[model samples]
Target: MSPRNKNTMLVKLRNDSQWSSWTWQQKLRLHGKHGLTRFFPNIRRKVNEQYIKYIKSYKIEITPYLLSLIDYDSQGNPQKNDPIWKQVSHIDLLSNVKSADYNGVNLNWEMPEEIHYSILHHKYPDRAIIRLTDNCLGYCSYCYLAQRTLDKKRKTLSSSFQIKWNGTLEYLRKNRQIRDILLSGGDPLLFSNRRLDQLFKDIKDIESISTIRINTRALTFNPFRFDPELIRIFKKYGLTALEVHFAHPKEITQEVDDALSLMDDIGYRPIILWRSPLLKGINDSCGILEELLVKLYERRIVPYYLFHYAPYSPARSNLSTSVKKGVRLLSELRRKIPGIAFPRYTLFHSSGKHDIPLVQEGTNEFKYEILANKQYIVKFKNWKDNWVIYPDLQDN
Candidate 1:
């Protein structure tokens, strides 16, 4: 691993996550609810089957609060931890390896000077993605980048964001054809308000970088970072737009709600991104997803992408859902739910936005399907008008 891949202590903590507020003793007492032990058997064992595997996978410390959410009861089954189970307990997804199709979603020639180091991935020329930084406030057990981050050699590689920051900025500055820049990866807000300001400042200065978007979860796990001063800085950077990543309804709390409201007050209204892989006993049910979407609407958050877990990292073997099946779940949920709360269904593929998915289609453009059944067909009533062309593309 080059020096560029190294991650900071905070970022490293993310890959090897831990709930700083709690103690290990407390965690053991509440590792599971009801009789979760019998089902997974050995979870509580000093060196249980799952724990040993998780350690090998390089998964960070699991907080007791999160552990308490798991189900151990005879009747609880895997569904008990549906919302968060797949994030960590993904032994099944890794077993089924599905190849990725990198077609229409190609980020194009903006493909960059370096393949492995380039954070930018622009599939639809209409919009471009800027993998601005490679760091996070906290890491998830099911993170696709787990292997990429855990390899000591890749540690500096993970921190490549800081290393390439200048070159990437230069590339964006020269590309006038690009209109939108999605600030992604390692959660942008994990940085200090001042650091975020400098980033947005550079971005806003660019003539082509019109809309600024970011994907983050600091508001959920570390709302303190969403301070008024930080929001104040964001409010000052009019070019930046905020996007929140929420895996399930359980992730939304009053604190998060207040933080979003604060963002609105400070000038950046956020779009909510709900993503998680479909684990067997976890959140595969149409009813559960529908309910979660409804909750999102209640809070005035626009539900963006509801994703089917893809095969990546240690959890991939245990957590992935079938392309056909994922599509089906989305179709069923859409039919049973209202449009206001329904989110756009999509999946991550090498091609970028392979809507529909490996099974069917998100559209002639794309669709986010869970099962082959195509249960949720996400369509915007006036989808065409929701966004305006970048002017240059109108004639293309």
Candidate 2:
């Protein structure tokens, strides 16, 4: 849908009494292809049988709140380049899967050796991530942890949290070197208030854990999830920061502003930070990113990291952009926005996270190599100072 029409629809939906009263769970009932077509009827014709089968295979979850943000054409079909739709919908999954295989892209990026139970301890010895739950209010098609989030044999929230708790706590206690703990999964915020409180209390008891950060898209997926109780839990345990994902400026709706206001009321605004992958047709333009970063800064949310899209599954290759393109965009952004509004351009490799150097007049920091098969790859120095080669997406 056109931006103007989208804004109009959003305004109308926000004022609807029914939409305003619905709980997060009710809003979440919009799941899979049936729910999608119910709202946007034209999608039924745009997507074929194969696409429907693929979506069901991986599963798709979209909240009414998020659905309201997507733009649709006059015919009620989602706009081809709609950022929110691109992130949540599985329309391009089959095609991207074919392209990824044709290009010989890696389907999985998780480092098996670095994983223990639900925790992933990579190059950073001082930090570790605990997968607290395997459910999310909504699912992003490009997520690197698709194996867990999209798994058919997914564990219940309670069981998943319980199973990981004991082992994760034991590991954290043994590793005094690890001071930072990131609570991630499908998203840690999906935990109920009581469960979240318990989680905070448990993690707080660890003497070695100095910082507790929650990686969540609650602000975007379902801002209503940030109620008074949730805010209290964050304050009670002293959450260092909330690493939020905001891929486009359009995502910063009034609801999101209201959620931020709640945090501001409690003086927790300083801890809100943003991070998102550079997706090809979504927020890849220099103007879009600048607007997104500026909007975030205006709301006191620090722009943390603009990541190079991880090619974790063949179905996500369409979203991936060349590291070169990402760095260039950041370099341009660096020139336009204030230093505080800028974020590091990073790439997550099996070894660790590495910041991609920006292109400059006389710098030769970026090292490129051509493989025997004529595929281009870039060499990066990992956190351990070991050189790692990564496939560079061929810019379209």
Candidate 3:
């Protein structure tokens, strides 16, 4: 056999063995900087002083499967320009400001007043979000919930919030206006099969709740997590739709395809939908996004939303792209791909989620203005019909 084929077989066997034997806890134990070096020798030399400092400031928890996707050089070191590496790793040059909002208390864009227990009653009456856990298998560099996921102390729901599962269910039961429940957090798929089974059963019991949407990134992070039991649970609950986060085309690996095939084989084929933030230098380009959306469409996944990167904290400001840039990219994409493959370019603001209008010939809602301090800003009407001014990230 060829050396390349032999190496491929060996890797497959190793992954299969690990999946069968290692518990999620065992896998998690191998996370962080040490795990990167130990599992992949290519990353050892790359773990320098800057990498150490970045991890110190922001938590690093990447799954082994996800780390394997990053491209490495002939010297056995991770490529600095690898898209997968850029998504997970922190770059010092991108963010220089140290913000005090690391705790994530003020980062709640859902608004504190609307929160009842662990439930976030969205400004829209139809849907509400339930934060299952403030933990994920891996941490994305541009995650809006960086404060909650990065800080180990706040992994669980805080006592001050008085959040409880029972209370959340009760709130949903009482509010007949809520027809949809979004199971979100660091990622709801991180829950065990037993926990997910019970959670699904409880949510199913809600007569008023017509749909339950789970937002997760597990499909890319660790496709092995979607074992037979999880598929069984999904089938039993009749869950047809799953919102997955896939930032780049590189994230769609053979393992991810196998997981989807497994689901299909079991007759529990989920209607997969994609949602991702338009991060600067990550997936901000027309070609990159076009490829990602087209790939997702080919796999029968709907391209749902391409979000404007939220600068929740000063530390994450570098990842933010100009809203105009995002719109322009989307506009360009509209001409290149099918309408079904096109994703809505959206902005999650303090007011609510708003779709940013593209640059068209007709009268547009977007207005550019210069402030007294010579700061550039964009004015757009929010969900509440109130005009809101957003800082333009052109200078950044």
User: Which one wins on TM-score?
Assistant: 2
Candidate 3 matches the true fold with a TM-score of: 0.87
Please list the C-alpha lDDT of all candidates, in the order they appear.
Answer: 0.52, 0.74, 0.72
Q: Residues 98-122, candidate 2, lDDT per residue (tens digit)? A: 3333222343455667777655544
Candidate 1 residues 56-87, lDDT tens each?
Answer: 44433333334434333332233434455546
Residue range 1-396, candidate 3, lDDT tens digits: 322222232245456646532254236433555655554455455455566666655667766566566665554455667777787776453346533223355553657778777546556799888878787877777777766676544546645433388888888889999988888888788777898899899989999998888889888777777788888888999886789989989899788888889898888976789999888788888999989999999999999999877645434556677777777778878889999999888877767777888863213577867788776667888777788866666543
TM-score of 2: 0.89
Q: Judging by lDDT, tell me the better candidate of 1 and 3.
A: 3
Clashes of each: 66, 2, 0
Worst 10 residues of 2 by lDDT: 98-107
- CA shift at 207, candidate 1, in angstroms? 1.2
| Each prediction's RMSD to truth | 11.0, 3.2, 3.8
Give me the runs in candidate 3 sitting further than 4 Å from their true place: 1-16, 19-33, 39-47, 54-57, 91-95, 98-108, 119-121, 152-155, 158-163, 313-315, 360-364
C-alpha RMSD of candidate 2:
3.2
